[model samples]
Target: MIDFITGRGLLLLSLRRMYELWVNHSSQIIKQFSILIGLPLEMSNNSDSSLEVFSPAKFPKAMNELSALLEAIAATSIYFKAEIVVSYIKSHSLRIEWIEANPALAKIVTSGLLKTFSLETLFEANRNNKNFLRDVENHISKQLLAG
Candidate 1:
């Protein structure tokens, strides 16, 4: 259908239609993601500023914090993501701070993850390798710590 329309010299029309579809779809997607990530979203009719896509502009801090937490789970996960990131920061005496976090780190992360991802989604992502999330955590700890 796209080729059919574009070949007939309705290229601008087709592009406009695709953009419309994208705007409609992305708003819905953003809303769902906001709920999952436990973030507030306010969409106003007068602004195109809210249409931005996800980027590392604000995620690196979150990633580093998450990496710090996952360090307790399995040492390799964070190292593999950024080689020597943890050790190098420590050696240089660089401090990475979290933005207003709870005292209970594990519970905080688990609650956020539970909100962000459903069991069905997790199972699908892991190809149904383990049925229980606790088992998954234990398995990683055992495997990484043993080796």
Candidate 2:
């Protein structure tokens, strides 16, 4: 029984290690793949300057890291999406505050995403669903990807 327990612990450790390696490799691949696809795609909209994609011109490393991090986020499960989004919001609340100061821009971003996802029509259907966080993340992911 002790030997069995030890084997099971080792297996769990190995699985965790594999997962870590996979995430690291995947992040690296995304970094490279995005570059190959001619990254830093320019996005513009008249309505919202705050929602504008982060400028690679100012923070190239941040741009790369955010891109890879967002890709990993996209691949995450719905249950964790809300947790991640909430954590992100908590961490970046200052940015959100600044963006919200320009209400028009926030409106444009929310409206544009709602239109793109057609959530404007069906928001009531899934507004309370746990997966809504996942939807929000996907929207943010798109905006980041546009950079």
Candidate 3:
């Protein structure tokens, strides 16, 4: 059982690392393009355009594709983390067992959910049309799972 848990933990860590790299790389590329276009990117106030940023000229297909990819990754990470929490809750035969075995673990896991929602709010509030919410959603999803 210990080996199983350890292996899964390692796998989660690896996935998280990969997710971080992808998010960072995507941000860097976006920042580079934003600079090249001489645009000072700002958050969108509208929900429809929140995750995207736009300028007068059109962006390349690859850039749009990358943006979409970031969104997908964010969604996936969110789901993964949610599943882990649900799994943990279900695995505990008794509520007291969970509380007794890992008193702080539950609180920490619960906080992950709170943090996820917080990021979601940030994403929605910014509304920059840069797909920032999608990026954040992806990051939180992965983090929830790994944590």
Best model number under TM-score? 1
Give the TM-score comparing model 2 with the true structure, all chains together: 0.23
Candidate with more favorable, higher TM-score: 1 or 2: 1
Return the clash pairs for model 2, or none.
none
State the weakest 10-residue window (summed lDDT) of model 2.
114-123
What TM-score, computed on C-alpha atoms, does each candidate reach? Answer: 0.29, 0.23, 0.24
Candidate 2, residues 42-94: lDDT per residue as tens digits?
33563443344333353344344444544544543333333333333323222
Least accurate 10 contiguous residues by lDDT in model 1:
86-95
Best by lDDT: 3
Pick by lDDT: 1 or 3, better one = 3
lDDT, candidate 3, at 75: 37
Q: Give the distance in Å from residue 133's predicted Cα in candidate 1 to where it truly belongs.
A: 31
lDDT of prediction 3? 0.44
Listed per model in order, the count of residue pairs whose N, CA or C atoms clash below 3 Å is 0, 0, 18
lDDT by residue (tens digit), candidate 1, 29-78:
87787566433355334355324333223333333443444554442332
| CA deviation > 4 Å runs, candidate 3 | 1-41, 44-48, 51-105, 109-121, 124-131, 144-147
